[model samples]
Target: MVIAVVADIVGSRKLDDRTSAQRILDETIARVEADLPLAQQPLTPTVGDEQQGVYRALDDALVSLLMIQLRLPDGIAFRFGIGIGAVSAVESVHGELADGPGWYAARAAIDTVHAKEGRAVPGARTWIVGAPGQDEVMPSTIAASNAYLLVRDELVGAMSERERRLTYGRLIGRSQQELAADEGISQPSVSKSLRSAGSAALLDGVAALRGDSA
Candidate 1:
């Protein structure tokens, strides 16, 4: 089984320069994939505002998606829905099309995010769902993942643009001195921002997801 992802810009119509935003989104996706190298299919723009991709594991999806969230510039944000199941490709006149339970679960997961955003957790940007008829164990995994995602989205949504950048730099093994140099700030300031913005905790969480030691 593969992990399928569906993503769309958070506020596409409100952007003053949609073309520039799309360019940044594309570039950021490329950069993250180059760094992480986990996606079975790198995220690519699909229809209208949505993008699609697949990963071999749930941890890979979580890591790459979080990096995308952090790497994006200030004005652009994406909401993601991840699905766990099987995918089949159908030959089509327009090339090949992704069909099956995996894509359907991804669609349902995104719809869940949309509904949650409108009700209480407006910061909710990601959700996960498993295909129907999965083994009993899968539901528990999905529940745990959704719990983690809720907190992850809230913390990321609250971070300043600079905080996000700093977090992303740290994730890719960039030193504080290097990040400070790039940001035109001091190393101490970079440290302060990471601590104050809860980036340290977020990074720890990411490490745990990746099966790395704390």
Candidate 2:
């Protein structure tokens, strides 16, 4: 099976003030390219704020999306539309292709994500578009999205001030030691609270939200 991914940076206009958005676009594309399992898979060009690429496996494509979402810089987010189907043709290095069910499915997925206001995660946050005979894939994506949203809501609803600090710190890539120093807490303490709040487990839940199994 072939899977196509289209990812766009949210709020591109705001980011334009910083560095013309080229650096961020390049960074996002590079990040996805590096994460692809198959070294031979071609990385397509970016059109303005959007980037597109293809993979031979649905699992690999899904993993690439998750990796990009997790690694994006703060104040910057992404919306992804994934379509899985058969490919009739792939134009060499460019990844351009003739219209087919796969292309239609991808367009549907993009519409779904846009309808959700670019929230491409589990629960109500992300929307998934699927094609015919995709029974196994669709349900899993939906279930995972739901589970992730549940965890996110729970954490945000109940976390204390200190807990919130540590959680955001980790989510935004701060090391436990750094968060500890900033918060005047021990590294162990930071880890403990994070674990107790199920932050790491929650991340696992979100990652699990993708794939053919929920």
Candidate 3:
């Protein structure tokens, strides 16, 4: 099974300097692709302000989504759609041309997120799609994933810039001590930031999402 991820900037068209958003997005894509074990087809830009990529594992995709979400500047939020299905086409020579059931589902997922955003759903960011009717396990998993994403996105969005940096560092496995040094704050202050921002709860959500929670 292949997992397809489709992502777009939330307000690219409104940006006074559109290129800045694109540059940041490109850098984010590069960072994610380099860090994750992607499928043979790496992330490639699509029409407008969107990009798509394939991942071998759902957890990897989730990590990439959170990383990108936190890294984007305040004006450039992201919406992600993850699809789990078959990839009928993948072009090594032209990664952007890849298409299949997975791609279509990812497309649908993004549209769903966009619709939710229009309805003023708070932190409607990450979404997933799969063939639903016949697949019991997959549907249940998707539901749980959505539940986790709802809280995760909202918590991240609510964080201050300092809190966000601390949370991102934590997500990437940086110790609180290291984060304190990075931020020029005491270790106790780092713990306080994590507590106040609900970063610890976010980590618990991530653990649940990745099936690591007991």
Candidate 4:
């Protein structure tokens, strides 16, 4: 199955100057592409601060988003919509232009993220929509995925800048000692940052998102 990931800068219009945020988003997206290795098309900027990408696997798409979330500056954020299905048309030579149910579902998914859901928090920044299950399988799967994304967003949103850096390093498999050296801090401090931010849980959640567990 093909997975489509579409994302846009959060609060893009609120910034007095959007240039810096755009730069960060572009850099982060490019880093995600290099780290995650998109199968068909790399995540490409579509509009001012929006991007779309296609991956050969769901794991790659989810992991890429997780990486982006962790590495972003405190002032930067994006919402993601992930869709899974067959790729019916490749408009460009490199899968940059795609037209299919996957893209449609992905567009629908991001639309849901922007809409209010009852009394639920409005910033459910990541969501997924899968093609028809031939049964009722699609709804339940999407529900489970969004539930995780909601909690993950809240957790990341609550972190301090230092905590975010530590979490990001930890997510990418960096050792605490190495991270401490990079930050010019003692290992204990790095460990404390990760522990205080509940890094273990965050890392596990990301791993689970990639379907690495169960």
Task: Output the number of the TM-score-best candidate.
Answer: 1
TM-score of 4: 0.85
Residue range with the least summed lDDT across 10 consecutive positions in model 4: 115-124
lDDT of each: 0.94, 0.59, 0.79, 0.78
For candidate 4, the per-residue lDDT at 125 reads 81
Per-candidate alpha-carbon RMSD to the true structure: 0.8, 6.1, 2.7, 3.0
For model 2, the stretches where C-alpha displacement exceeds 4 angstroms are: 18-20, 32-43, 90-98, 118-126, 133-186, 189-198, 206-214
Each candidate's number of clashing pairs is: 0, 5, 0, 0
TM-score of 3: 0.87
Candidate 2, residues 133-156, lDDT tens digits: the string is 766766686567535544454454
Q: On residues 1-214, what C-alpha lDDT tens digit does candidate 4 reach at each position?
A: 7888788888888986798777877787777666666447777788777888888876667667777888888877888888887666666766545678888888888887887333476657888988764237757766786787788777877788788888888877789999999999999999888888887888887778766765
> TM-scores, in order shown?
0.98, 0.61, 0.87, 0.85
How well does candidate 2 match the true structure in TM-score terms? 0.61
Tens digits of lDDT, candidate 1, 1-214: 7899999999899999989999999999999989888898998999989999999999999999999999998889999989899998999999999898999999999999999999999999999999988888999999999999999999998999999999999999999999999999999999999999999888998899899965
**Candidate 4 ranges with C-alpha deviation above 4 Å:** 90-97, 117-119, 133-138, 209-214
